[model samples]
Target: MTHAHAARPPRVAAGPAAREPAPGALPAWLAVLWAAALVATLAFAAVGGVHHAAVGVVTGAAFMALGAGMVVLLAPSDRVFVTRLFVGGFLARYVAALFITGAVMIAGLPGLEGGKDYLHWEASGWAVAEAWRSGSPTVHLTDKDPGYYYLVGAVFALTGRVAVAPLLLNGLFGAGAAVVAFFLALQVYDRRRAAVAGYLAAFLPTLLVWSGMVYKDVVLSFFVVACASAAIAISRQVSARSVCALGASLVPLFMIRPDTGVTIVGSAALLVGLTGRRRGSKLAALAVAGGVLLLFLAVLQGAGLGGKMDLLARFPNPLTSVAVARESWANEVGAGSSGLTRYLYGRNLLLAPHLLLAAMVLPFVLPLPGTTGGMMSIGTFLMPGQILWLLLLPGLLAGMAGAVRERAAAGIFLAGLVLAMALGVALAGYFSNPRYLVQGVPLMLVLSAAGIGYLRQRLLLYVSMLLCSVVVFCLYALARGS
Candidate 1:
């Protein structure tokens, strides 16, 4: 029943073997310069009250320097440099993404209000601390989940209250998500394409904006990517170390947001049930894990611990009171067509079908305005925008089609997509925000890369370069404004 005795498939050609180190690799001194530039840019933003223009100049200079260092490090001939660059690039991207998002949130975008919900969370965390100081055995501050708040509170406690911590943390999560996405893509595609996708996901504008905020979406994104990466590793019959890594990734899901945790656990159980050679044993192990998780949750709730456990309660009834509360909040926030009352009652009913369609299509077509400085305003409905966006749909379809011809990639794609969709639908209430679609970003990138790979001789190169240019421009605009 084990993989050791499982049916073996025909072996494909192994990937490239290790090459000898080249002497002319990027010098250590150059790497140090790149790191110093990045560190200085971040430190200046953290302390100095610089203008947006100045901050942008510093940020761009640092990133550009880092990118150049990466190019030198990745040079194929310099195997040692290539290895160093690959590792350094990954770490640099993670830190840079976090710093940039934190800086932007600290800078505060024009017209976009700042420091409302975040302040509230911090206050709630303070309340938790006050309760602890008293003789209270349990601390129930507010309805909001305290996991993120506690983490932020610890940072605030150490640094004497900074407004940028939440955003910075979110950015860090975004960067982590990007790194995970890159490795996941590499598993399905080649190393170069995977690296590109990872970098794009990290630096993408919409992602950057979210990273700078105090929200659970970015946190959810990190776990989602971790889950996907774990699944990919498992499918490849990778090392036991990889399996342990997958299990460890799932731990955060349980604590960050229980509903997501349940969905992930359920999906993993389902996959194991459907595919595991020792189905009974696998199911038993899953049941034990699920039971233990539920018991822990029950203890937390019974102890009157902080925050609402609505995430657990909503599982049996997906259309629960929480959904109703969210709908009410959305109406209050004027999310739909007209006034709150109208949108809540008659307008929502009228627009339900169209909204559903938009929900399905927007993720694919949206050019991620965070990347393009032009606000994702009504202008996105224009013909040029429509044409540009349509390419993603066909690109994704073509990649899936191509995967059908390549069984290994197909399995990875199907597993990842199904898990993604389940998580997406489970978190459907937040679909209005493009950042919720971050998990799918890698899949889209893979498809786009596949399309380019498939049509390398035709207009593919030109088209890919054009898209890349647009994306880079958008990122530059975002960074400049920050």
Candidate 2:
């Protein structure tokens, strides 16, 4: 349901030189940067004791030096170079993801104390693998998503009981989501903003750390971004490819997290109805919306919700469900430290706005007073990342404003998606964690990029670094005080 408004050109200026570069060609230096990132990944991996540590260190060292040398040799603003940065940023982010995954595996795996959710999911996967190997392939977990377990099982079936299966899968999916986020921004905004969105999606530490783990958050995030990206594409131009991507993206989302899928589809439909003009586009949107609803019902029934509605019966009041779940999870994960956690420990409709605010800010201001004991806290190791997010918050807001001003339909869709997901997670309660908030990270990143576009690059960089330093100092002081 898009309005027939003309798309606004972005504010960022492209330098003179090759104004009409060949399509699909990027700067060669990006490849070098990507290579460097890979080498950096190997070095990080080696530090985690994954074997070949020496080789990784040597390889990374050489690549870093070479990439550095090329940085001076290459200019920043050739048409080809500027256009290619998005792809390069996407690829290089994966290398960074490798480093994160390696570190997580090194620190948390095989009895170093990690999230219970990880243990449960991994165990379920192991069971699924065993079942598949034995020709049963049936999962008995009443409350879990069978698709995730089966996915893990399939990996085990093919590769045989590898502990790293989930880690690698998470990393790949996370990386793919980052790229898709870039493409999504490109579909709706200018290349400069798209580039910012892509790079932000790649390096968001929360995403990086989650990608390194053996959980469904990253997987869920990938599908969410995929569905959103595909939706944006189809909304703008209904094509076989866009339609296919949209349809395909829904399949996994349905399987992995039907509830989330339902919310996302519903949100998209509303946006379509509000913004779309073409009859064909509207029909296509309706088809997808209806398909997603039916699929969600099927998943629920298959998961045993149809006959008894036992899960629904447990929480007579969904708002209460949200509150209880959030509080319980905080205690379980040691996230009780935050002021927001304390404020949200009890259920009340009056707290709805507060709930949204808490959800939005928790990713940036975490490990507050009550968050001292949980495995998810990671013992304040995430503090710096939190600080970075705080620094970017203003930019994220500005970007959202820019998106709405420049591309109202897409911005509305993103806002609706984020709001709907927040409500869904709150209502569902038990499994709610900030990890689920990762679904909104790409949207925020896109907005942040737009915000960044409004300022001079050098000025923005200096301000960002300054803010970062101050945040780091505050974090250090807080840590010491604690």
Candidate 3:
């Protein structure tokens, strides 16, 4: 046996350690470059002396630094803490959004010419309360949404000081939305991807500019993201706890905007059906719970708990009428098909390069400039160039397709719901703007991050990074100049 034994091959022992890039392997030179870029951006903003430009520049730089740190720290970590990433990105985004919003607020503060009247609602609410107390039966008002006013009234009733309360509340909601957005992204992707997505949502200029304003958009966006996040969590595997959260989150959606709430419910139902989890008693219980909630909302609306609820019930009809009226007004204003179409086309063309440039640089830069209302306020039908920016939707769709391919079920579901909602608004003849599409922006970034992850060539990654930097710098410069 020993003489006839076959030659034995040498056995290699397996080790605990796995091959990885050396610590500090990433180019130090790149870090230096990022630092230089941040400094240059701040310098440019300071030199330009645009209103509150220093705040913009500094806040933006801080975001960039934090984002870069996150990227560097997480790049080599094999185990990703999804929650930590989400929280960190949320904090970064919130800080950036808060700073930009403050700048806009200062610019539009009540005392300045053409400045925003932050105190308008507060003053009006007090006036109405005073009138009501004085036995004025006909305390009528044009603004029907009473949620903000009621909250303000309550504050005034308690404190006898109503200054800036409404604006503060709106700012709080906006900041809260930024936090929720981060968690929502984390629920769908790994920590790194979620961080990027959250950062994108938080830093996007449109959201920053609009969130702090006393408007419904911030509240709506918060509820929308919360509802979507909850639904996605339930779809992954319906737990009693998750179901409860989903149900609770829906309440805010209904309260803030009933039409959007309906859309969310419909999306959830579609998701549940597609998931094929119909046989269980738990599922049955969840259905009943959802039904009860809907019934309650209907009852409350009927009883006039919130007049907005009643308005919501008649939304479809009134929305159609508004659309018709808008069209008629456009026609009367000589903004008919030919004129509006030409304008839309021209604006779209003009903005195309800028938007494309923004897309490239946004991923790399921190505290990216918020989308000022200037461009988006220009009606879509009146500006072709503006309509062209809608191409971002297609880009987002492509990114979503990539998510689907990767079997990111949650991402796909959320993205689908967002697309449906956006399409509904658009088809109703409502004009589209980058701000309107901000909710979908995270999914787009997630897809882009996934794509980048798949293409792991160092040279290519660096080249892409360079391109992003250039785009961000150029866009910031242009926005400042404008």
Candidate 4:
């Protein structure tokens, strides 16, 4: 509704820039995503049994109803494509979640015992839910990501006592994230790019796979994106409504991922403070943004949360992280493919700041998976998503230049987001966990969408650099005997 900071062509139109896309705009790639999930589900059914999958589908459908119901009630009347994208996003995650747990368990994939963090969250939430239902105190569960377990527990209190309930909710949240992403992209980019971003946000293999499983990251990601969307709105208009929306979305996030919550708050404040058209109005908006930031920090600190803010000003400092300089280096390095379990294994900071370099090259990665003997001996259920990441790589690089540019207010906020996430990853060394990348996926997709057209121009150059990065990194690993 606000065009104050909107980017546009020289030519103008009276209608909304993000008009309805062509018929069948949701596209067949979404179908391919579902098909991949289906195959994985089938694999689980054949290997494990149908019982787990049946429960998953039933449970997923229930969660889908709740999440989708809210969307339908609140969604703008004119955006049919948003609704379609929502369905595609929800179904992809729901179907993927249906049997993914069993598939991981039986196949002995990476993080097999706990299916990474999903089973941990599910089991813990189930216990917490039972404890709450029985009116007992002291539901002993993980302190890490306590928000996820409690939320999952709350859902179980109202639904069937299904173990797969969290997965279903994950599917729903994943869809919510896509919808949020659609609006975020529309902030500065055109309608067509927004649509591409919407679908990519929904069906990108990493996003769908992570959300399909029961874990904190996907849930946290939805809230993070929601906060960012609200922040962008605030940056453009500084409305009472937008500020409240940001707060509503941000409170739950302190426990989900404190670093991200704090970063967005600070970033939003910076944007509001900097982008005022009139000094008088800008001062008022800055006061509001600043007031919220100070109040939130005080409240969150008092609640024994936001400890991540203490780490905020330290190494991999968000203030200087991923400036255009590093982005240019990333454009040259092209080395996000390898999970940085031991990047710079034996090297010192003089040669390369491993995590910092890893941080700059954003897409996402996984620890090279095999039998623990060699990288060649591979047998994991995550192949599809990793393969998908490879395919998305070029678009990611192509989009790099856009973020680093001096862009609109909405665009600057987005660039700040990616920079903050890169810093978060560097400091946390959450190298092996793809979940850590959840908050950045929409930006990556939006960037990818924006860059897709220009990719052919440097197709050969990027591919060769990527191959070189891989080969050189592998040789380094061999030399170190890792």
Best prediction by lDDT: 4
TM-score, every prediction: 0.58, 0.68, 0.53, 0.74
Off by over 4 Å in 3: 1-145, 151-165, 279-395, 406-408, 432-482
Candidate 2 lDDT for residue 78: 35
lDDT of 3: 0.47
Backbone clash pairs for candidate 4 read none
lDDT of 2 at 115: 65
Error of 3 at 247 (Å): 2.2
Report the Cα lDDT for residue 335, model 2: 47
Candidate no. 1 TM-score: 0.58
Tens-place lDDT digits, model 4, residues 340-362: 43343322223146544556543
Q: Using TM-score, rank the candidates from best to worst.
A: 4, 2, 1, 3
Ranking by lDDT: 4, 2, 1, 3
lDDT of 4 at 138: 38
- Candidate 2 lDDT over 1-482, as tens digits, reads 13434465546656623353445754555658667766765666566555444343343344334433443344244334433443454445445445544555555543323467777777777777787677873746425457677777766565555555555566556655666677778777787677678777866776766655566777787788878877776666668987887788888877877777776776666555545556357575676567556444433332334222355554345444444554544464324234443444433236455446544544445443234344434435455566677767667656656667776788767765765665544434422245667666777777667666764455765487557645644543353234
Q: Residues 163-248, candidate 3: write the lDDT tens digits.
A: 33343344444444545566666666565555555545544444444443444555567667767777877777778977887788
| Model 2, C-alpha of 199: deviation from truth (Å) | 1.4
